[model samples]
Target chain A: MTIKNRSRITVFILSFLVWLALTHIGDIQEVIAGLIVAFIVSMIAGKFLITTEKSEHIVKRFFSAIIYLFKFLWEMVKANFHVAYIVLNPNLPIKPGIVKIKTDLTKDSAITVLTNSITLTPGTLTVDVNPETKEIYIHWIDVLSTDVEENTKLIGGRFEKLLTEVFE
Target chain B: MIRVIGMAFILIGITFDFFGVLGLVRLPDVYNRLQAATKCVTFGSAGILFGVFILQGFNNFGFKALIGIAFIFLTSPVSAHAIARASHRSGIPLTKETVVDQYQEDNELKDN
Candidate 1:
């Protein structure tokens, strides 16, 4: 099947499933209505819903994405505790600053996921992204290191690695 | 047994939230406060939603709770990014303790 048709079908199925979950399949009439609505929605939105080129390794990507989610949760919980500790400390020993890091991920979506991951993890928050140069500017709570390569490894390494697997 | 586990999850969530609010109050600058509050609170809310899912099981309410968690995870960081970028562009100064300003330097270099 053409990629466009595949995406339309995918959208239709997803929207219908969402409708079922929302309405709880109250009756046959509801199911019929959901199908009709999902069809309309997919016709309108299918092209825009997916931007990445169609991949042959969809199943591999899917499993990696799930693994990435669990790892992300683990990282988030650890970081939250660390930030909490810093907040509760009376001295507030934070050396906040914006630092630049380089990224190799070319896909916009991949870059976005990486930026958000950095923002939510540890003491880093993404302040700006230079798409042209593939550099991300992050406001770090503690100025642990100034070297760009070290900061990239410290902040974006794990996420970038996993995202490249999933998105590349 | 499940209910008890769910309660534990909720308790942990509330603790995270309390710390998040405290961070909001104590942090030194706009960027710092955003970092503290957004990260802590987003995960705290996710914890609470997961607890709800645990308590509700695989029914409609549980699925909705899971969806809510997904939505929060996706959107919270985007909003935080937007706010941080806007404040930086609007010339909101970082706290006096900030050690570097690469974003400002980059912009200055661009203009020159």
Candidate 2:
């Protein structure tokens, strides 16, 4: 309804349309059709779109997110090697269980990134996020309780914080 | 050269798809399964797009691939978050080896 909201919606739609056009450009006719469809879909979904502009220092947050992503990627590479080793060995050394880990991030996006990044890892899975308790119930192939909070800190304090700086 | 790249992309995409499905079936937990599917599918899908680009050079196939990849990137986490939230809300006990929880601020905020 407001100019800001309308602008947000338009940007969102355009971004989506661009993505579609770029991905599906098999033919001229198809690309044109995709554009039409994207336009139609956005128009239909316009009413449902909620644009609440929260301040997240864009430049600062962008850099932070980049750093976080870099760290996460590195960690994933290492985790994969470890997981691969476990897989190759006849004895699967994975002692799996779900553990409750608390989060410290205040923003929804920050928390989302943290949990998703956790899911991205090989041995660890983000099983659940308790709304009431605000804790993450994660399933780890290998659990080490003494370092649970610390590990979460590593997740939240390190990556989540950087993500917050990027997107919050 | 273009055709070669396209073929490579297609081949790689197919392989990633295989890995994605394998991870989904073989992985023990939902989270791990999700990781495999999301990551593998994403990478595989990218390969497919690359192959398409090689063949078509930025047309409809590219658009479709990009759309699918972006949608997966945006939506996968959301669904994962929803599933995780549901599991957590339902009060499932965590694995025995978990060492720490770092979400104290969130808990305290709820208390407040």
Candidate 3:
């Protein structure tokens, strides 16, 4: 099979597994219905679902993505505690402002992951992206610095490296 | 033992949710509120769902809880981004103490 066909098959299998896990239906009729649904959905949408150019290292990418997920969970927990502390403080010491930071990631998927990671983290939100310069505008609850390099290191430093490994 | 851990998670989740609500009420503006709400739902609700999963163990209900957690994790940030972008575009003024305005600079450059 061609690489695209293989990926579509992979998508179909993954989606079918997810459907089975989610529905957990043992009835034969329901199972048959689910199989039909999963096949149809995958056939219609699989091409758009997974489109990584580097399909050779699928296993390596999957492992790194799993590790990245655990790291993301840790970051999420830390962010929660950090924001909770700031919110619960008597003075509410927030210095909200927008800062511009550059990202070296070129792919649309990588950029989306970076922005979503930033927004999900407690104290920062991605306000905009300058596609021409690959600069992201982030609204940070704590305006630590105006320096571009400093802000980039602060915001994208953790996930950007891992994401580069995963996507690029 | 699992029950104890689940209860602890539930308690922590409630505390986070309470503070999130407090932040919503006390914060100065829309952006800050988005920060609180997003974190609250992501961490707070996820924690609760996780606790439910643990309490139920490997049963069907537990699987549903896991699905709920995944759904929340995937969707919360997108909605928050939508709201933040909308508020920013509609010219919602930042809090008085905001130190910088890079977005405005970009807009000016676009206009010129």
- The better candidate by lDDT, 1 or 3, is 1
* Model with the higher DockQ, candidate 2 or 3: 3
By summed lDDT, the worst window of 10 consecutive residues in model 3 chain B runs over B11-20
How far out, in Å, is residue B110 in model 1? 1.1
**Candidate 1, residues B24-98: lDDT per residue as tens digits?**
999999999999888999989988999999999999899998888888989999999999999999999999999
Q: 2 or 3: which has the higher lDDT?
A: 3
| Candidate-wise lDDT, in order | 0.91, 0.62, 0.85
lDDT of 3 by residue, A124-148 (tens): 9887887889999988999989999
Model 3 clashing residue pairs (backbone): none
Each model's DockQ score: 0.83, 0.26, 0.72
Order of all candidates by lDDT, from best down to worst? 1, 3, 2
Q: Estimate the overall C-alpha local distance difference test score of candidate 2.
A: 0.62
lDDT of 2 by residue, A28-60 (tens): 776667667766666666544444555657677
Q: Which one wins on TM-score?
A: 1
